[model samples]
Target: MSKETMPAAEAQSYELAFHVLPTVAEGEVAEVFQTLKDLITKAGGELGVEEAPARFELAYEIVKHLEGRNRKFSSAYFGWVRFTVDPAKVEHLDEEIGGNKSILRHLIIKLTKVEEENPYFFHQAMAEQGKSETIDLDEEEAEATTATDEDASESETDSEVTEDKE
Candidate 1:
């Protein structure tokens, strides 16, 4: 393949939260995910981390089993996928996913400029600002408390003097 036509080993990163239907088998997940990866790569992109499944019991059944075939009928599988895709081809992806049976639901979204930025650095900057703000507030509260204490002491002294006269 020519350099431009060759699949990119790495693409601008993205994050996706994906969910699977309850009836799907765990063993089949990898193949299903690969299908999505191929689709993105063929359209020009790269896939990243595959997050662990996050499952919860379903509120209602999706399919009913035979009278006594199996008791497994009430849970769903979900996970997150991070990948990079040519921004232009993203629309076509929605169409492919819409037609898929294995995928209960999927959404391919562009990360906001903010989310695409490093969160660690952003949070650190905010924390430094917060630390300075907290110090300023503490100093103000200390001054107020000291002033209140002095006022209380002065009132006690005044009462003591009046009692001495009586």
Candidate 2:
């Protein structure tokens, strides 16, 4: 018998969570995710369940950015991707994600075991209980809130002008 004790075909599990800039359009967000999926496949990784994008507030602004760019971001559209990949190719994945302008932030963690279920399922369940930052407001309510904010902004500008002349 051969002296092989381990399987050579084993793959490593990883959870990828990323935030696309809030300024990015919905269609652009789809395109960004598609590009990521393609990258994963090209790297010989198998993509698993994807979590739908959701709006969330950041605890603090992200100031330090990749490469030579620096930006302050308060919020972003969050998304997650689950995949099984070889450890040797992780560096490539990092470069691919880090170089993308559309992605404001990203994280990749090696898992100890394979988990086939959606990685964001627990978060979704919490969101249903109103524990998440995502707010689902009716159209009319949202419009009303926007109008109120505009009025507040106008008043603030007017006060600022009066203060400048004084």
Candidate 3:
């Protein structure tokens, strides 16, 4: 993510997204994120929302560090971070992210502004699954209501028959 230009203003914000190889265990995941946060702060950047690391398949086979420390990875734990920092330090931040061996890929896009509604990277599919499960409750309620209505109608018919018998 080493862009050629960064303005001098200190108020600039950015989104730093990256993928870590799945070979790394969950316990070690925190350390990698902490390293990135330290890098951003040291380079005069403010850390913002952090996207939780999630497992996803890669678009293409990435032979990471193949020339020297060769390895093949088909999937990774993807994460993203929002941060604000001085424009001058963007290059250094890019270098830091690239140099990290644990990081398989990284992208740093300078954001014009930060908004809450923008499509943030997260595990939306999981939430959607949970939502779909909730629909069962609504279906159950409808069935219960139908059963109560049937009971009420039967009770009314029985009373009418009793009155006719009397």
Candidate 4:
């Protein structure tokens, strides 16, 4: 088909999940994130929901080859951004992100309609889970303490009975 006759490509929803190298100094992390967002905008992508990068321990060590040497990291700052762009432009976006040294790894996936509408905030969910776990531990510890106190009293009662018999 001739270029003039072809319809313009429709923009599709996509999400970019990326892990920033842990070596990136805390202060510069924001700059790196902004750069990534800028890349999306520059590529004719419209930005949508995004989560700021937050430090997290990786499930396993990740090795990245940089400057002719392999570097291993056990932790990194992870975040994700959602956007919409023509499918044809995704390849360029992928190349730009891959060439970035600050990013340890990244994945860009076409998002389903449901995923685009309801976003999950990983960090917030983790924080809430941690709080609930702490509360459960506290309750268990209190129960253990109460049980020990009762056992101690029973032991004292048994000694009193022996003394009376003597």
Residue-wise C-alpha lDDT for candidate 1, range 89-115, written one tens digit per residue = 666776786567766656665555686
lDDT of 3 by residue, 33-129 (tens): 8888899999887888777777877766788774478788889988888888887778877988899878999999866544533746466765677
lDDT of each: 0.58, 0.72, 0.75, 0.83
Tens-digit per-residue lDDT, 60-82, candidate 2: 78875645877788888888888
Q: For each of the candidates, give the backbone clash count.
A: 0, 0, 0, 0
Best of the two (3, 4) by lDDT: 4
Q: How much does each candidate deviate from the true structure in C-alpha RMSD?
A: 17.6, 10.6, 15.6, 12.9
lDDT of model 1 at position 99: 66
**Clash pairs of candidate 3?**
none
- TM-score of candidate 4 relative to the true fold: 0.75
> The CA-based lDDT of model 4 is what?
0.83
lDDT of 4 by residue, 23-131 (tens): 9999999999999999999999999988989999887789989889998999999999999888778887998998998999999988878888899998888888977
Top-down lDDT ranking: 4, 3, 2, 1
lDDT of candidate 3 vs native? 0.75
Instruction: Give the least accurate 10-residue stretch of model 3, judged by summed lDDT.
Output: 144-153
For model 4, the superposed segments whose C-alpha errors exceed 4 Å read: 1-8, 134-166
* Model 2: pairs clashing at backbone N, Cα or C within 3 Å: none
